[model samples]
Structures are given as structure tokens and as C-alpha cells.
Target chain A: MHPIAEPSLLLNTSICKANITKMAARIRGWQGDFRPHFKTHQSAKIGQWFRDAGVERITVSSFKMAHYFAQHGWKDITVALTCTPIHTAAINQLAATINLNILIEDVASIQALEDHLENPVGVFIKADTGYNRTGIDAEDFITLKKILAHLKDTKKLIFIGFLTHAGNTYHARNMAQIKKVVDPALEKMLALKTFLRKEFPLMELSWGDTPSCSIYNDFYGINEYRPGNFVFYDYTQVQIGSCSMNDVAVCMAAPVLATHPQRNEIVVHAGAIHLSKEYIQLPNGNISYGKVVKINHALEWDTHDIIGEVKSLSQEHGVISANKKIFAHIQPGDILGIIPVHSCLTAHLMKHFLTTEGNFIEMMK
Target chain B: MHPIAEPSLLLNTSICKANITKMAARIRGWQGDFRPHFKTHQSAKIGQWFRDAGVERITVSSFKMAHYFAQHGWKDITVALTCTPIHTAAINQLAATINLNILIEDVASIQALEDHLENPVGVFIKADTGYNRTGIDAEDFITLKKILAHLKDTKKLIFIGFLTHAGNTYHARNMAQIKKVVDPALEKMLALKTFLRKEFPLMELSWGDTPSCSIYNDFYGINEYRPGNFVFYDYTQVQIGSCSMNDVAVCMAAPVLATHPQRNEIVVHAGAIHLSKEYIQLPNGNISYGKVVKINHALEWDTHDIIGEVKSLSQEHGVISANKKIFAHIQPGDILGIIPVHSCLTAHLMKHFLTTEGNFIEMMK
Candidate 1:
């Protein structure tokens, strides 16, 4: 509802707060620590909403983000990615002021962290529970033992627990598929915890992925949850059965630049630079960049009134393929709300958000 | 490269200057105005490079960028995207000081601009040659005549020319295919120009697409050329045969965070945020977010020594699928250079550039 002239990220605060409240209550009901990932919104102002929901600990993707939130009073922080030794200075500075935790996968990284760290930091052995993107394979016990044995000699590094991001759930198309992808990943993490309990009896288990966290009620023995994207469930999450369209809190308000009635398409000011190039393959063998929704004069959108889909994008242009019913009502100066395929990337690209109540939320640059 | 602890954009200034010189000379050889699009780099310091090559006019995609460049002394500027009525205030302010031009495709937009204009501004009729993204179709003479007739009643709008961005050339896999996509688009533009000359004899023709401009020696009858990405050709351009690997002036210097020897992969700090999530599909049915190049002790990469390819990307992590040789040499502390798939999006994401010579070039935020 803000007076936006250009492509702007519109955040529905009520919906965002409800999402946080529901997730926080669910995690508390399961007796798990909810160190929700702050990488999705990257706004210190939005961090206050999580704090209102009784979340104190947080997870960030980068050292810079950790520092940003630390400056905003987030004391307990975890950097979820593998910590490279090149950021030794940043690690030492951040660890000196807060309860800093970093993920480590290989013995080499553990050794590198131990050699350069000037302050103590919690280390989580990143376990690969099927998302083969990064982290130590759950079945690779040799590397785990080596990392544990090497950490035994370290002065600054404190082994905390095992952590896994079942990112493969992002590829799931339905609730059953999501469960199929996550059940095995959780089993692997639990198995690894059991195997390592002989030497590391106090170790905790950390598992988080938006789909699995949103769908399942019980987390078995996992001690902590760190899902980020659930805060702003997008078109992709809706497609993956992680969350419903009603839970989506963020939408892009883009101005229509031109309309091509013959082609049944309208070009908007939003593009890859605004919404990100992430896309989903539709059932009709077409790729959709985002789903378009009608914006009322009050500048609010209804999730159920899905009008069209963004068929293509360039540097600063998004072409939405629309049907005659909706296309007839659209004009060059009209504004349309688009639910991005991936809200995390969209938030990152927009760098800020305008709440529906006309307040601007500043994010880390 | 410049003591980077995070993913950083690295610019080879020599290669960038060479790209500018070559493109300027070729445009001059064809007697066309070289208004290189500043949206690729969006840096005032880099704009100096174009000015040094005798380029006074420039093209940008947004009003914010047009204002930025105008402040930096760029007098002749064309906002290459369709102008919306919502930005009338910005348009009036910008056009009040500079020789500003905006693209218009329909009579509605022209009416909106005319009704809101407080200063004189040049207008170009956007013609959709083949991209089918925006603009009036070249064969849609009825609409063209209607727009021209409507513009005749305008007080502050000055008709400039017809402009077309043959973006279809981006999908071309080779130089021949590039020509195949551009030749007909050029013919359509020429035919439209000849027909429009009956009433608008002094109208100009502006055509721009990096692939077409870089591959073709002659831009017959086109009065102006505005190729933006040719300044920093990317992996997509190389695959499109617009330029060779040597022409790519920018590379992302990302810190290696973890190495998975069993999977022959390494995780880097460069991810979707750093690389813009633009990818090219390889012939082997694999998607490459970027091509990995070896960075020596001097932080210089040899185009011929491509070490691997970025197979997947998350928010802040890039998974490089490497061979045993490259995987064996990589460590958590090392820094690797990744040539991005699309330089424009990458440059936009990285707000500044660190030249190989260690100087930071600031861009418009």
C-alpha cells in the first residue's frame, strides 16, 4: 500500500508475524531450540518480530550477516555454512562479543580454524544428510572421527553438535515426496549422533529445511531447528508443498510498462535484477519466473486471485503471459503484485521491503 | 584478489578498456553512434572509460541510473526501457537538466507522458523486431500510425526514432545462428523505417543486442547502436559466439569454504547472490552457473586453464564440480576465480568492482 514508483518488495507484516508465531509455537511444542535462519529477510527490524515470538538465537549464511545482526543485539549466532580460514579476523572479532558458532566439515578446515582463531567459537560438524551440496557424508565415519580427534587438541574450537540441511526437500513436488526426502536425512543425522555418542555424549543434533520443518510435527531427537525460507514462503515453496499461498508474506509490486494484447503478454518493470533468476518448471512444460496477482486500488493483493505467470525476464523487464480476462483490465501504468518463485533471492535482490502499513524495513546491504 | 574475505567482483581493467575500444571502433566504422549502455557496469568511474573512447551519449535501464550518469556529466542519455507514468516527477526533474530520451510503445503511455511532462523530452517508438518481449510489432503499422498521430498533438514530447532490442540473439549458440536471428530483425526494422520515412523522414533507427553488435561487421542503416554487455562479455556471450573467453573482463573471486574429495566437488562462498543465479546449459545436459578458472598466486586467471564448473548454487554457496586434479589442489583457505554466466547481472549484484590493480571502482547503489 506504499506509494511505490519503481519495482518494490511489499511485505505483509501481519502475515509475517503469524508465520513466525506459528513456527515458533510448533518448535516449542516439539521441545526444540528454534535458531531460525536470518538470511531470508536480512533485516534487523524484522529480527524484532522473531524476538517478540521468543526467539533469541539466530542463524546466518555469512560472517557479514552475523556481524550485522550482532550489531542489532542478536547475541547467540550461528554461521550455517562451512567456515573458511580466510575469515579468521572476522571470526575472532565476532566470537569475542557473542556466542558465535560456525559449521566445519573437513579436518583441514578444523585445523585451519584452530591455527588462526584468536577467540573461542562453537563448531558444528556439518553432516551431509543427502543434500550433497556440502558437508561431510553421514556414512563417512573416518572423516568424522578425524575431525573429532583433531578438535580434541584444539584450544579455541569447541565441538558442539552435528548439523544437516536437507536441501533436497526443495526438489520435492508434494508432501509425500518431501517426507521421502527428509525421513532418510533425519535417520542419517540420528544414526551419526548415535555413532558419535560413545566419545561425544553431549553432542546435539541440528536439522532444518523449510519443507520438512513445515510439514512434520515430530523431529525425533533433533535438538535445534534452523529453517529460513518459511518466513516468506514463495511460489516454489507452494509448489514443493512446504507452505500454502496464504502463508506467503512477501510480494513484488511491479509497474506495468507495456501491454502486448496480440501476444497476451504484459511487460512489467520487475526483472532478474529485482526478482532473481530462480524459476520453476510448470506442469504444462513452461518455466514460470513468478505468479502474478491482481492489486486493488488500496495496493493489497489476494492470494486466491492468481491472474497470470511471468513467462520470461531480461535485465529489467518481466513478461507476464495473461489470459484475456485479466489482460483486458491491465494498463501500462497499473501496478501488479507478483509472488516470486524464490523469496530468499528476491529479498536479497530488493535489499529492502515496504510493509503493507507504509513502513520501510531497511535490510543489510 | 584484493585481500578479499568474501565473494568479490574482480575487473580486469585492461580487458575492459580493450573491449570498449574495439566496440567503439567497429561502431565508428559503420558510421553509427556508440551509446554504450551503462546498465552493465553502472559505475561512474567505468563511464570514464567510455568517455575516454569518445562516447558522449549513454543508455541506462532506469531513471535512478539516468540521474546518476547525468550527474557524472553524461549529457545525452536514453532510458532504454518503456517509461511509466508513475515516474513523471523523476522524468521531469531529469529531463529538465539533460537531453533525456525515453522509450514509448503505445498511445496510452504517450498520452500519460504528455499530460504529466513539465520539460521537453525526446521519445522513441519501441518496435518489437523479434524478441516478443515488449514494444509494438514492426508489422503493426496501424498502432504505429496511431501513436505517431497522437504524438503530433503533444507539446513537450519530441519524436526521436524507432528502437528495437533484438534480444533473441542471446539464445543463439553460434555466430551463424546469431546472424540468423538478427538478419530478419534488421530487415524488419529497415522495412519499418522505410515506411515510416513517408511522414518521419528524419527519424533514426536504434538497434542493440550484444551478440548482433559483436558478431556483425555492419549495422546497415541503423543510426545508433547500444550494446551494453559487450563491455564485459560473459560465459553466455562466449557460448553465443559473441566474443571469446578473453573478452570477458570480469570474474568473481570466491573463497573456498569446503572440499568434498569423494564427490570431486568444492564449495565456494560465491552463490546465487554473488553470481545472480544466471546459468548456461552445457552440451552434456548439465547447468553451469559459472566456469571455474585457476587463480594463481598473483590473482590472475588464464582463460585457457578452466579448472571446473559451478554445478549448483544456493543462497551463499556455490558447488563447483571439479576433476580429481583440481579437487586435489583446492583447500578451504584458497581463493578461486569464477567467470559468471551473465556479467550484467553479476555486476549489478556486486555494487562495486575491485580492479586487478587493487583499486575499488564504486557503482551506483
Candidate 2:
């Protein structure tokens, strides 16, 4: 096996396929479109795995991401973030060929789309269920309906549906807490869907966040499932009761640079710029940047005998406060694999993946 | 001005040059090496700015960075992080030409260097004062002296000096607190130097953390200055009284994608992926992702009249809770500049930079 000299994201392709297979099985049963958000993986090779599992549609976070996947033969895709006129050229270019869908919350974006769109495209009105980050507040369906009416009256603008990202579920403490956050949002969406059906009965509805989408099985009414993070579950997802450590498919392989037995801290080359600055506070009130797991020569990891927790990180160093016995076992040149707190940010930071099979999977630039 | 389509790191060349000039003047007066750490602004263009100000020696955080600067004609360079055997090949490769200096605390690295060094290299024994991250503790001079003695006997290894990074100053509440952190650490370094000089009389002493190096001018005993983050002082530096907002050299130009008047929040295209997850808690105990600043079309920013505080961030979105009037005035397509809480991580995350002059500067990849 090649030494994990510096911090590089590693993928276990078998585990990733298993994760995809499990999610696909659950999502396929969801009486709706299963357009997994591509923003998490952002790899065309991973998209092929999805395609092999019968997924033809996807959701992405930006125009650049959408364009990358579109060029790779994904015909149906949604740029899940709100549309901006600055990306009009790329939007127009992509809309001319494929089934492109965009999110719009305010009337300004609709106006921009109307002004600059060279080709007609489907649109999802981003209605806020409760995240409060974006989308028109779902409670304000009156204004949303008026906008929908305006869109219906516009030429060639396909008013597809209402979409949302229930991001509040990310902060949930447990499955029940996740349900508490997600149920109300789903209720609000259903209420809006029923009301909007009066004018446009065929309009669809979509909502997703990894915790709510992965753990909660009753996603019956939603027209689309857009959860992205489940593909590469991280420590945060494990904490949220969405996935176990075994299900996580990606881990950052960092070279151990130095070890301090006095402090019981292991310094690794992986840090904020590699694993990202995202962290989850452990039950003991200490923050863990990522979960550290030791792997055998075959690159198979057994988290049962965990080495340490990455307690903190600077720009280029991850400080791990480990068990002294475990610390004694580590050498300076050894590679420590860290299960990142948030896989999406880690993937974004790494920009590429080296699978256990030694194939390099490129991320969308 | 070109419309700001997405988040791009904007560098104010004039302010940066002024910062370089000011710091260089301070170091020049000290009559010691002015090897400002290049890990902050990993751009060749910014390195050129340092060169324009008569900086010849440089400190980098990694071997790749050292090579990049070497390619740009920086001859005397130090890789400030602890040495690991995995990087032996690159270390030998770079040591063959440039005056490459490396940090080491343990004997394993010495053995590795002895095995692979194709050319002689300078070595600094890293000592720990209080950060507890790396380096042998200052009081552990017995171990340090043994290593130094070994290096003295070894061929191709020049034992130069003792170095310490008082990184705890990063958490200081203010300038006085920063001094409280630095003064003791410096005293400890001085004491170590006094004791070590009895045997190794020619050894140098160095200590640095941007807050201490930038604010406290008394560098009577330190032989080298290695402050990296002063080049782009950010909100953290301003809060700690190390530098003012006017001295801040870089800001992230993020496109306003949407707004929520009710929540008094504006959403932008920049998020953790762009600005990094570093943050500062506001005086009110609210965690802010970054400091938001309003800027004119000329790309000039007035930090005194602050725009807003980035209250929260996700993978691809930053939520700014600004003055209601400012929030009210913002259009969907407008751009807001954000002063990152920690400029080093922000710069590392950005990967490339776009100057206000519309030139693209590549980061050291």
C-alpha cells in the first residue's frame, strides 16, 4: 500500500457503493423522484454509481456544479440554490440542452431569469419551511401563490413545484428532535401543496436534509428527495442518529507529523484546510474536529478500537488527544485516518478522492 | 467594475504593500532576520510584494510552499513545521539547491534526514513554551540539548537555533492579554537561550505569533521574526488589538443571492467553503461567521461603517444579519465584502485570488 504521506481524502469504493445502494433502496420506495443532491460528492464517477442504481436526476448547489455534471451526461439536474443573473450565460447554455431546473424565492430572480434566459427551463419556488436561511417563508403562501400565478402566465416558464431544504434538522440532538424539526416543515409543505393545488394541481414538492431524509422513513408526500450528505456520512450524521461509523464511506488520510506523549496529543498534517474547520462537541463538552480511526495495511479500518479524537485543528495541523496506549502505538510516519465531522466540506476542501482501489476520482472544479 | 458573480478573494494591493512596508521596517530596525511566514498569503504575487520591500528570507508551513517560493527566487527559506520522515524525498530534493531550513524536535527526523539528505540543510530545534501542540518543552532542554549535540556531530546537519510558536496569543482577549501570553513565553525562550548559549554560543533564538510580533515592539533578544497572518489582518486581529480594520489587506467579495427582510438576514454565495469556518463571538454572544463590510463600486471598503455580521454559514451559504436599512438596500445580485475572522484559513480555503484590478493570482498548489 502507498503511504498516506500527506492529508488526502480516501474513499472505500465498496462501502460507498453500499451506502448508495442502501439509500437508493430506501429512496426508491419513496413514492417520488429520487434526485440525490450532487453537491456532496461532486464527482461524475460517483454520479455513474448512482446512475447504475437507476438514478437519472440530481440536485446541485451551484451553476458550476450543475454544468460539470451536465457535461458528464446527467440529463436531468436541478441547481438547487437560488438562481442569480450572474450565472445567466451558463444557465442559458445548459438549459438549451438538458432538463435544467433552478430554484427561485423572490420575484427579482424570476425577473432576472425572464430577462436573460436564452432557453426556457423548469423552476422550483424555494419556500422556507423553517430553516429561515432562504426560500420564501412557507407561511407566506399567499405571496408565493401570487408569484406562481405570475410564473404560470409567463411564456415557456415551466412552474414545476415548491422545494425546500429543511436545514434546521442538522442541529437536532437526536432522531426524535430531527422528527420534531422535520415534521412541522413537512406539514407546512403539505399544507402549501394542498392550497397550491387549487391553481396548479400538477405542481410537485421536494424537501431534504440528511438527518431527516436518511433517518425518517415516511417521506411519502414529498415529490422529490434531495438529501446529499448521506452519500458520505460523517461524524455529525452519526451523532444525529442518521448513520453509524461503519456507513461512512470517506475518511481523510493524514500523515502523523509529530506526537507529544506529555500532552498525549498527536499532530497530523490534516487540518482545517484539509478536513475543514467543522466540528462536533463530544458528549464530554470537548469539541472533536473529526473522529480518528486506525487502519490496517490492507486499508481496512475497525473503529471499535478507536485511537483518538481530533480535538482541535489549526490551518495545517490536527491536534489529537488520544489514549496513551493508543498514542504509544503510533509512529511519526504513520497515516491517521479521520472521519470528518462534515463530509461535504471535507470533499470540497480535498477536491479529489483516492479510493482504496488506487483509482483517483476527480471532483468537479 | 466587473459584476461580482460569486465569492472571490479580493486583495487591496495598496494596503498590503503598506502592511509589508510597516512590518519590514520594524524587523529591519531589530537587525535580525525578517523571514515573515508565507503561509498566510500563499500567492507568488504577494511574495513579490514582500520581495519589493527587500524581504529575502521566508518561512513557509510546508515543503510544497517552500518549493513554490523557491521557484519565485526566494533562496533562504524555512519550512516552519516539524519534520516527518515521509517528506524525506522532497526535503532532500529542495535542500539540494536553496538554503532550506527545517524544524525538528525528535531524533527520528534526524535519522531520516541522515538517510536521504542529498545536500546540507539548516535545522532549528523547536521548543514548546505553552501551546502544548508540538516541539520539546522549553524546560526539556536536556532532550533538546542531546538532539542538538547529535546534530553537531552529524554531517550535513547544521544546528542553527531554538524556535517556538506562542500560538496561545491567538486566543487572547486583547492586547494586554496577548502580552501576558507572549512575555512569559519570550522570557522562557530567553532563559532557554541563556542556558543553551553556555555550550552552543552561536545558536539563534526565535519566537513568533502574529499578535505578539505585530503589537509588542520589544524584540531585543529574538533572532528571527516569523509572523505569517499580519499580511491580511482580519477581524480576529482587530478584536485582539493587533491591527486595525484599515490594515486588513483582504476581503471576500460575496454575491448577495437572496434576502429575508423579516429575519433581517441576507444570504450570500460565500460560506465555509470560501471564508472557512473560523468565527468570532459577537459582544452579544452571537457567533458570527465573518465580519461583513459594505463597499462602493470602486472596490473600496469602509470598515468603520460596517455592513453586517455574518451570523451563520453552511457549505455554500453565508447568512448575514446586518443593519436593517443596509439589508433593505441590498439587491439580490449585489456583492458584500467579508473580513474573515482568520485570514490564514480563509486564504488557504480560497485556493486562488482575484485582485480588485481584475487580475487572477494563483495560489501555491
Candidate 3:
């Protein structure tokens, strides 16, 4: 069979290793344990890299993912989702196999779990801080008291403290602003934990999300940290100051398929299927889906190696302009490195990964 | 298993069959043979719906996809990509197995294919009528003519006239405007076919894409039509006037896992994994990643009802809220139907399929 290489994806393992090492150091410096969220990487091989770096505890989004990782010998896992009755059986199966932790935000969900679960699963009450998307209000200590009282009455649930994902940090303009939002939110959670202790007396606060944990070092009352995307930082994290542009290790390497001279555009085989159609609005008001990092035969990233701008994209083609000085050097046979706006979506679309040094890594199971 | 009766996908097979029947009739009425593209639905079982509706030919984006459908008894297929030297062996294998038609725009690519293959294969010259991404420009007809002449002398390639996808129709404001852009571009291809017939006679003039084929009906000179997304219309198709809001059959149904009363937002279990993060900019200048469809009695999908708007989406949750009237009725117990902005990505993400009547139909295999 001929090599199916047109719309192939390339992952920079060197950069990926560096990002993980850097994140490991950052979390260690903050005096916090790093439980990297595997939802961003999804690959067990990539997860193995973290495991080699002494990361035993991990976080996943679904029960299926938990099972997948558990089979791969990941001992401690927190299924980072609100416990659902639909997924209770899977959760039960996973908990029966390993140290599985789950998140619950509602008393009704806790009651359902209390009725059906075979074993006591470690439950973390999802706190709704200022982000205000999932958790119950922290001021409503009565609600927490009611759930804790019910769990205590049933004797079927184990409280592993509280967990909160300060997702609002993603909306911040800069690191200082992200700190301004997250610090107060963390403080609010600490106060809520203190109030909840009046009823349960033994609770911990577990805070996650790469934006808050990657940028800030002060983990005052937070017991555990779960930052996933730091393993493969992208344009968004660079712009947010969570990582430098040089630290962004993984990029979707796509081929220049066809060139359009009439519109001064070159169509790359990479489109939404390879590099997801996620756009980043730069500080200079430039809205680009991705940034071209470097071309082929280059070791380090060329900062000015902005080969082309994506003008339009379809399922199979990314239309880039060849009007830049770099474009004159980039031929149709050249490979272009692109920093995806969102690494999660890009990782999902790919089936395999090609490293910078030409090692082929299979991403799909 | 607790039935997991959250907002889950429910495909109406009868509705899907009827939609295919309607599309086939429209293509026949327009005097074009229906060669439905399978990228949108990506299910061999669903492709059978088109075959049952009298579709004999098909188109796919990649050779792997071509092999995928070919195994399902599809004979006539076109790998709708710019033919490259790297994939010539796989193309030959597929062509040997089925009546595979390949697309090539560059002269060097065609020459490379000519040098590699001994078996006769049908080749369609992909022309850039307006969408300046992949195809050779119409202004470059002299170059195309030279390439065609060279291929004809070899007597191995069967010239199948011109084929163009008016992808610019995707960016058009409305259906009428999309037709205005497509009609002229299609006419240009017909003109190319007419001009080429004197030197090298050709049989077919192919055109496709949901925006052009689904929205407009005037394919007078076009011989074969290919459209995939008509089976599962998305927010993009709804905006382009290809399908009505009711005609959209597939939706990501997710249960409200948590609600924050203070922030007036609720988080659903469905996120980028279930429904892709493809956003649609509404006419009012408000951009939402997806629209909330109707929920059923089982909190699945209802044919006649829908509620709320998805305000923001994260990796594993969709934050939805409407006005006070909408929020007052919404609770943590309810399920919300979310119609994705992009059907292809969303459908691919959902590796499993469930029918409206609750048959667990496996589509990915």
C-alpha cells in the first residue's frame, strides 16, 4: 500500500517532554502534587511519559476513559465529571478495579449513587466558585450540610473533600488578571471548606485547570492540582502567559497540498480534520485559527517563521496565503508546523502522531 | 444500567430514508445522477439508505474512507482529493477493487500517476472556478489542456471532464447568494467541458457540496451531484437555507449535570467530545457554538419542542441559559438537545449511534 501521508498529524515529542517536565517543576515549586488531566492528551503512551515522571494520580473526563487508563495500569484516577446515574455502572466497575474518585455537585445525584453503588467511592463535592457554571453556591452552607448529613445517614459515600475547576481563568486577558480572578475564587473556596467543616469537619479543596494552576504558584488552601493541557501547550496558553511560545511542544504538522496563485493562497492537506478550526484572537486584534511555527529541516522554532496565514478552511484543506517572504521558500513538497489554537480538538481529530525526529507514534487505540 | 436516558442522540430511520428519497428525487429532477458523498453521515448503514433510494455512485474524502464504503458494496467511488505520488499504490489497489475515480489538478501529479500505474483509471480534472483552494484555475486551462493531451497520448487515463465543488458557497450570506456564486462557477466548468470536447471528449460534469446541491436545484449542465450533509443538516446548513430547522435529524442530547442559580447557567454532560466546538454567528451578531434542539419525554429528542441556548462550552460540559422565562422552567433534572454547528466533526466524535426507537446501531465499523 502507498503511504497515506497527505493529511497526517505530527506531534513534537521533544517539546511535549519539555512541557511536562516544566509543568512538573512548576507544580512541585508551588508545593502541590500534580495530577495531570488526561483529557487533553488522551493517549496512554503520552500518559506513560507522565507516569515515568512519577505521576501516579491522574484525572479523566469519562468512565470509559477511566477504564481505558485503568487497563493501562494507572492506579489512582479521578473521573473529572459530575457523577451521573447513566454512568454509575461504569463508575462502579472502575471503582471495583482501582482507586476511582468521582465528582458530585447535587444531593439528588449523591442519593442515586448511595442507592446503587456496591462500594464506597471517593466523592469530591464540585464547588461553584465565581465561575458559576457547575457547582452549587459556596454561600449555601445549608445545602452542603444537607448532602453531608444525607451521605452520613446512608453510610455509603466517602467525602474526599471539595473540588473546583476555576474555568473562568481561560477568559482572562493575561496572567496578572487570571491571578486576580483565581486567587479570590480560591479564597472563597477556602472559606466554604471552613464552613462545611462545621458539619463534616474533614474536607479538602482540590483545584484544577491548566490556566489557573500553570500560571499561579500560590496554592494556599488547595490540596491537589490537576492541569492537563500543560503537557501540550498551544497558541491559547502562550497568549495567556501560562507558557512561553517556545514551550509549546506539540503542533499539527500538515503538508502543503495545493497552491492558489490567483488568490495568493496555498491549500494545505490539514483542515478541521487535522488542525481543528479553533481561532485565537491575538492581542493585536489578529484573529487566526493557528500560527505556523517552523518549516521542515529546522531544529528549533523560527520565531519569524510565520509561513502563511490561514484565510479559509474546509474539512480537508486549509487555505493559506503564499504572499509572505517565507512562502517563497516553502514549496509544495514542504511540511509546515502549525500551533493549533486548541490542542484538545486537534488531538481528537488525529489517529497517529509523527515526532520531530521522525518517530511514528500511533495515537488511536 | 439505569437506562442513562439523558439528552442522547436519536436517529429517525424513517426520516433519514425519506430525506434521502427527497434528495435523490431532486437530483433526478435536476437531470443529474446522485453520487452522494458519505463524509457527512459516515455510516455504511446510512449509505444503504441512499442506495435504497437509487444512488449507484459515491464520493469520499480519503482512500481509507473509499475502502470503508467499498467494503459495504459500493462499487463506483471517487476519492475527492488532489492525487499525490505518495498515495498512488493505495489508489491503484482501491481502483483495482472498485471503479475508483481520482481527482488531480496539477500536471506533475498526473505525470507521476501515469508513470506509476499500468491499469486504466478514470481521472477528473479538478478545476478552480471560484473557490481558490485546491483545483487548477480556469485561467490555467492551457496548462490543463496540455496535461490532458499528454494523458490522452498515453491512452491509460480516461478523462472524465471537469469537477468543481463551489466551497465558497459556505461563506455566502444566504441560499440565493450561494446559488449566485455556485451557478456561475458551475457554468464555467460546463464551458470548460464544452471547449475540451473538441480535442478530447468527456462524459460527466460533476458538482457537489451540501450548500450548492442542497440549497439550489438548477444543475442543468451538471451530470452527477454529490452532497453528504443533507442527511444530517447542521446549524451551518440551517443558516445557508439548505435544510429547515426541523429537517436537522441528528443532535447531541446531554443531561443537565449541574446548575448554578446565582450565575443563571447550567452545565450539561455533553462537551466537545459529543458535540464539536464549531460555532455559528447568528444574524444578531451573537455567536453560539450550537443551538438547543427539542427534548423528548425520556429527555432524548422531541420532534416538536426545544429549549434554551448554549452560551459556552468546555471540554466536558455545555453551559446553557436563556431569558428568565427559559431559566425559570429549566432545572438540573432536565435534558437539552444540542444541534451541532458542524455535523461531520460531531458525527465522527460519536463513535456509536442510537436509533430513535432505541436500537444500538453500530455505525463506526
DockQ of 3: 0.54
Worst 10 residues of 1 chain A by lDDT: A295-304
> CAPRI verdict on model 3?
medium
lDDT of 1: 0.90
Give residue B141's lDDT in candidate 3 (0 to 100): 69
lDDT of each: 0.90, 0.85, 0.75
Q: Please report how far candidate 3 places residue A142 from its true position, in Å.
A: 4.6
- List, residue by residue over A256-328, the lDDT tens digit for candidate 3: 6766565677777788777777777766776677787565454344546676566556787887755545555
Provide i-RMS per model in Å. 1.3, 1.4, 2.2
TM-score to true structure, per model:
0.98, 0.97, 0.93
Worst 10 residues of 2 chain A by lDDT: A148-157
Best by lDDT: 1
Judging by DockQ, tell me the better candidate of 2 and 3.
2
Q: How far out, in Å, is residue B223 in model 3? A: 0.9
Candidate 3, A283: how far from true, in Å? 3.2
Which pairs in model 2 have colliding backbones? none
Stretches off by above 4 angstroms in model 1 are: none
What TM-scores result for chain A when each predicted structure is judged separately against the true chain A? Answer: 0.98, 0.97, 0.93
Candidates ranked by lDDT: 1, 2, 3
